[model samples]
Target: MSIKLGIIGGGVMGEAILSRLIAQQVYRPDQVLVSDPQAQRREVLSQRYGVNVTSDNGVAAKADEVLLLAIKPQVFKAVASDLVSKDGNHSSASETLPMVISILAGVSLTELEAAFEHQPVIRAMPNTPATVGAGITAIAPGKTVTANHIEQAKTLLGAVGEVVEVSESLMDAVTGLSGSGPAYVAVMIEALADGGVAAGLPRAIASKLALSTVWGTAQLLQDKQIHPAQLKDQVTSPGGTTIAGIAELERSGFRSALIEAVQAAYRRSQQLGK
Candidate 1:
């Protein structure tokens, strides 16, 4: 069965999802409804994808089976108030309320449910790379969500990239690890490129090598199914260059620094949600 999908914002992330959906033809453009206050953004979406666009949040909220709250967490309460007020007259329990999938970072399921009046809420953390259809999304369902709701969330998230299911309690950790993980990885890639440049490689070539190295290493980890330590050992001959660099990194406490960064992010997520 075809599902009606509603997007309740037209910011970068919301537009990214819309663009990917259109590019992938996951759903008919006409089936997607978007509401955003920004006229320019709405015009861009409507002109490019032929998706329905409106300034009224209620119009978007009422038009679809799956509603994505793509607005920022700071403004979410106001948006949720509007949705709940508009839903005041909706009384068909047999017809499920729209499955609310929120991509607002650090917003908990309880906060979402409370804001939207106990709607079936799925809180998801998707990274910025979703704009390129290369994101990892983590989904955590609220107490009111059903099995069908979870599957629906997965299907929608999977349209963009890989989707992982995690306990709502662990969602903060996911936010720290994967949601904010891209920036950390980007920093490492930049540092690697800098090192290549310092080693006399041209800047352009060094960048390409750094990115490819990271990508290839990730693929090896996934495809080889060997532990990362084993892979490192395989690359590091006794007293070899690889081992020397690894020793430097170990001395610099790279692993410990990463661990602390993730923990900090997790704590920040928890604070933001509260």
Candidate 2:
């Protein structure tokens, strides 16, 4: 059966994109197909989203339009092997080849193209916050991809959050920064909440305060289009509490620590790609 969108995984990230796409009416439930090995996952997706589900990966891989790969990177090769026939072909000769978009981290275009044969491939890096629809994703296209292929990918990924186009060379850096950024931001919020507790706030109140403060600060920076240093200066009046906190953070090398964290993560992404 022909479908508009084929999804090769029904995991958290896949479900997030699928739910958003359906809720936004980008694709009707009838036009989508999801493939997962677990019967429970297939059942959950079918019942919750009212979309077709299958245990066979090849069925979804041959979709009439776009195919999304949301599975873990470690299993990509093994799962991709399941899509190929004995003749080493996945797509029907008469059908329009599907555009393949992979959200699997560290799986290079070289590997994907080799597996998919002539299909246009786009590699993407998206963070965990995508589950909540507040994430950002960066996509890099393969040699065979055209502008239309990219716009189609943006539409699919945009269902979850913002989409950015970047060269494959910078994908590892994207992974280190925005791709793993949610964890860093979460840690900062958690630490801030702990600090509030140390200063006499209740745990629940501190948590809420920390979360709101970070979120509001981000919104303010984005809306106002101001530099972070400018925001810092505005809050750091002479001998004020904000300045005192800033001094402590600076003394503890907070900024450098974050920078180093991204660099370290970038290095790790490179290692994984190799």
Best by TM-score: 2
Q: Write the per-residue lDDT of candidate 2 for residues 154-246, one digit (tens) a residue.
A: 998998889999999999999999988888999999999999999999999999999999999999998999999999999889989998988
lDDT of 1 by residue, 1-274 (tens): 2338888998988888888877878778989989999899889989988998889888777645788889978898888777667763133556556888999887777787776654688989888888888888988888888899988888788777889988989989998998889989999999999999999999999999999999999989989898988998899999789989998999999999999999999999889877
- Leading candidate by lDDT: 2
lDDT of 2 at 138: 96
* Residue-pair clashes per candidate: 0, 0
How many pairs in model 1 have backbone atoms within 3 A of each other, for residues 3 or more apart or on separate chains, i.e. clashes? 0
TM-score of 1: 0.93
TM-score of each: 0.93, 0.96
User: Would you list the C-alpha lDDT of every candidate in the order shown?
Assistant: 0.84, 0.91
